[model samples]
Target chain A: MYRISDQQVDFILADIKKHGIRIESLQQNLLDHICIIIEQNLEQHDDFEKFYREIIKTFYKEELKEIEEEAIFLVKSKGPFLLLSRLQFFLLLFITFIGPYITYDLVWFFNEGHGSVLPVEVWSGTMVFATFPLLVLLVLYFTPEKLDPLIPRKSKILLGIRPFIKIIPPTEKYASYQQ
Target chain B: MIYSSELIKGTLKTIVLKLLTDNKKMYGYEITQKVKELTLDRIQITEGALYPTLHALEAEGLVTIKTEFIGKRVRKYYSLSRAGKTKAKEKLNELSNFMETMISLLDIKPKTI
Candidate 1:
């Protein structure tokens, strides 16, 4: 077995940090794990830096920062919540808010006692109240990736008691790694 | 010879929790090796997924960690907390039931040892 020098260990740690892993414990975990692999595999004469880069590349698809992002995302998404995708949330808003108003108008139209035609204010009210919010939600849900800061295109949304609501940006790379 | 990434797509947490329950404690690499050994190298847990999940479990208070200095490196060991023990049982039961359901649904025959 090859023994890794302190300098080689330091080089690994710096490389991990430079790759964008911010959390200390996570950094250390990667350090120890990579060091063990090096000790077990690499011989003393081999190029440590090149071998290290080759191995770490397999850790992520795009970059190392995804791990930190995923860690933060999972922590925030925990506890009681209604997890929703983009389309589901949009439909939920429509059903909860707009559906009721449309139902009210339908019921009024067919009723024997009330007039067949809706008052102008009632039509205006539906147009005024429901349309604005519905449009806002539509825009928020469908906003382009660069333009939309709150919810990314593929992110999961959590609606809950504690945090009220949160948007977890998608990490499709590691999404399959967990349930 | 197969990698079970597709087969084990969503059961990483249950596996880890159960491992911690069976053993007193584990570190990141040890957990990976144990899984590989137990599964006959069919299931390999990646560092990208393992560290984050472990960190999340710690943040959620399902697991506790203690570090020891080994020369220049610090080795962190993880053990289940009181809540983690309860959680592990629940997750195991859940996964077991899910497997049973999958077996029934797919009408696959279980191989006898």
Candidate 2:
């Protein structure tokens, strides 16, 4: 017969609870499974720790991220909204970059191109330079390896124009954490 | 033995539900251990895989949790709800049918003339 320490049992139970598995009847079910493995390994003259590691290794042959993805998928087909919110932020980048440019262009056209040379050139040039790089960054951020081919080129170009959406926010470092 | 990953994947929910059905009440480690025992130590359940499944089942309202103090720590015990029991039966029946089909289809060996 194989024996599990109370501490080990506690660790396992804690992990299960943390993951949100609430079936108490399954508790002994898992224990029985592990007990059999340990017993077999002991019979074969393997050390307890070695046997334990082998069993764990066999069970989780895939990467941790893959396991997490499967679990998340199983739990809720519609994933957490936080990720969707991030995608929305990416979409907003496009609007921010293009909005000011369109406004500026329309104003210049209506005024018969009479805007101040220094300010107009400065503003328009700044928007162009800023938006271009910002769009590149967004593309790199959102483009998943497998889904690259699925993305429309028009969307990619629109994304490239997203950086000039607003004036770049000033950077500030908080000092609250300083001892 | 390393079974096809697909085989394990399809039956995970059924396996879990059946385990719960047998034990009545158990915690995380206990569930894994029971599966290993019943499978004759051929199948092992990992913490990485098990925790997420448990959480998913809880989220689906298939299981209910009760907490108990053990020494300095609290242990969460899991048991099937009424819905879980019904679901388990359905899943088990589905699995049994699947197994029967698989066995019938694959049990034949080719004859050498």
Q: Best DockQ goes to which candidate?
A: 1
lDDT of 1 by residue, B6-109 (tens): 56647778889999999999999999999999989878898878988898899989999989876688889999999999999999999899999999999989
Evaluate model 1: give its TM-score: 0.81
- What is the DockQ (computed on Cα atoms) for candidate 2? 0.18
TM-score of chain B of each: 0.93, 0.85
DockQ of all predictions against the true structure, Cα-based: 0.69, 0.18
Tell me the deviation in Å of residue A135 in model 1.
Answer: 4.0
Encode model 2's per-residue lDDT on A1-179: one tens digit a residue.
54555665565556544543444544433444455456555654446666655664554444323345445444444322222223454566555765567566667666766554436684777677667867775665567454444332222221112222211111111111011
Q: How well is candidate 1 docked (DockQ)?
A: 0.69
The candidate that achieves the highest TM-score relative to the unseen native structure: 1
Clashes of each: 0, 36
Question: Which stretches in model 1 have alpha-carbon errors above 4 Å?
Answer: A95-116, A141-146, A161-163, A170-179
